[model samples]
Target: MIGTPRIQSLPQGIEVGIKALAARCREGEKRIAAALRELEAFGYLQRVRDRLPSGRVITRTIFCNQPTALLRPRRPAPARPQASAPNPASEHTGPSEQPAPEAPAPLPVPPPPPPLPQAPPSVPLPPSLPLVPPPTAPKLPPGPIPRPDELTPELDRAATALLSDLHRRAPQFTLTETDVRQLVPGVAAWLERAAHPDAIRHALTDDPPVPLKRPALLLKHRLTELLPPAPPDTQELAALTHRPRITVTPFQTCEDCDRAFRSPTPGHCRDCREHRAEDLRTAA
Candidate 1:
């Protein structure tokens, strides 16, 4: 080593080491400050408060540790006296002084009086209701017992007259018998035959359709057809003309006699007709 220069005042080894340590610490502080500034520039830290070079906080800080001075409280201004008119008993003399007054003694209060009781109400009497009268029964008029008329027949008159000489006799009863017979058996037979095609065509061709009845009625009906049609002025005559009439054009073979009748009337030939006439005369 080069000759150590004699120093006017020499630092001890501990002192030099302390100086070196302090320089390192100062460099560390500079690095920490630079990193903090970079974070702040990158928006990592929000500058809430400004700091002094000595590291003491000037304003209140949110995240970092730094000493802040306690703010001294401001003294309040002295109160001025009001301009209101003062009472002689309440006038003040000094800042610390107060007005004095005569003391009062407490007074005793008496207890309240008790409530009065009320009397009970009396029961009321009810008036009696009027009684309703019963309804009267209706009166009936007497009827007359007159004698019977001579023309009007009495139910028990014959028995009374006949039983004049007898006592406790019952009257005889009479009942009339009614006779009912079916003379025309083929009333709706033609109506059923009207459904046939030949009958339908014939009805279509004819001025009016024929009626439904027996051969005797048909013979009479054919004779009626020979007469002229009625005039329109007389509705009764027109109705008679318009009235349906049937006619039987009998075939050669007769159903009743089994003999062929050459003429139109089949069952009652000229001989049969004479026989029928004589039978009718005998019956008359």
Candidate 2:
């Protein structure tokens, strides 16, 4: 019999299959199956098979709290007695009675079927088919691979000039050939974007937005940010010609103070020009 706690713990409503019940109870499948059979025997659980209209048979489980009425045992039917052979001595009193007919001999049993053929133990199995290999990608046309020493004279000249300028401005931050090699790619990128060498120099020398711990890392970041916009495509340029052109102000740099400023003038900064005028007036 199932314990009260266990019976109470049994899931209600929808049926949880045998595997689920076994998992929940932490018991083996055979043990859970036997337990369920015992419960059914005690009339605690009833299993009913239902045949659907689709010809599919499904077993339905019903739980009962109260014990059901025990079924009566079925009695075996009495076997009929077989006829015995007639006695030869009893035939003398009745001479007129005909002799009993001889019984027919039993038929012989058929021979057993032939044994099936089995494979030899020493024979090896046939080799399996080889797997198909994956398709190879199409070969692409090879282009010239860029090397550090193979840079064009113009690019090489620009890289050297930038390195020399950096050395002249900040001698304490000396760069090695390896450092120059690493920095060349960034300089090349800036050049490719149509940035002037002078502008690259200015950006490198200017006070960084953040303090630099490593010159190489800081220079790389500055070059990336200062990369100029690419030239507009021919199609875009043609499209823009039809639209009204908007005038844009050009930026200027002071020749005397070397400070960048927004102005229509070409040479000295406003402060430098003002100072020069003041000095001239004082002299007069």
Candidate 3:
């Protein structure tokens, strides 16, 4: 059995049994069992289950000089795998120790979260402003006034004279030079409308409002609101075309009867006035 080609050529993982061993040794089962018991007692053999590369488990009979050496777990073969038959004359090296695993990388540390935004500071409010009184209004709406350039110097002088006489006409309408200057424009505009000087004075002084505050503003409102309409176009054209002549004659003492009368020339009475030739014939 030791030098047989069949036993040598057989695969590594054959089934384990005492019958096959007894057959090979030409002994009965009882004698083989006795031999196996003696081998176990002497620590030269051990039977254990082993796994094959094909994932099959089978009982294997192991022979060793020292059974304690076989107790250490053996890693899988590196150079030659157990799946195929090993070469008969090949020299096998010892199993190498396993390499240690490298330490795992340290866990990364996250940066601190961004600082929370700060709130804005509060501000105080300013004090409220005081209320003001509104200016007083007149009884009428003063329309647009004539420009200073539009008023003639003579008309301005006449307006000033007429406004100056208001105090004499009505005792309450006393005014200052500044007030008169400011009102001259409105009065001159009235004169432009052909309003007589006496008529303007009468209209202003006739019914003066009691407790008059600003005389200039009052007069301005009256002049604008109560302005007269322009003269008729025919009369204006006739006056423009043929200027009318007015002769002023003053009354005087008559040399004959010492009576007063109207005459174109000074120093004359009613009978002293020259009569036309038609008047003499009518008298005859």
- Cα lDDT tens digits, model 2, 113-157, are 335688678867798855754467455553322233246778877
TM per candidate: 0.12, 0.30, 0.32
Candidate 1 runs further than 4 Å off:
1-27, 50-57, 60-284
Residue pairs in candidate 1 whose N, alpha carbon or C atoms collide under 3 angstroms: none
**Candidate 2, poorest ten consecutive residues by summed lDDT:** 69-78
Q: Give the distance in Å from residue 214's predicted Cα in candidate 2 to where it truly belongs.
A: 2.3
Writing each residue's lDDT as its tens digit, candidate 1 over 224-253 gives: 333223234567878888998897665676
Candidate 1 C-alpha error for residue 6, in Å: 46
Candidate 2 structure, TM-score to reference: 0.30
Model 2: number of backbone collisions: 0
lDDT of each: 0.35, 0.64, 0.66
Clashes of each: 0, 0, 0
| 1-284: candidate 3 lDDT, tens digit per residue | 22123333546455325777656667677766677666656654566655554567767665444445444454442343234455656645766445454343322222333456798986877976536534553334447754343789899899999999899878788899998988888788778778889899877766767888777777777776777776678878988889877877777777767788777666656565554445777899
Evaluated against the true structure, the overall lDDT of model 3 is 0.66
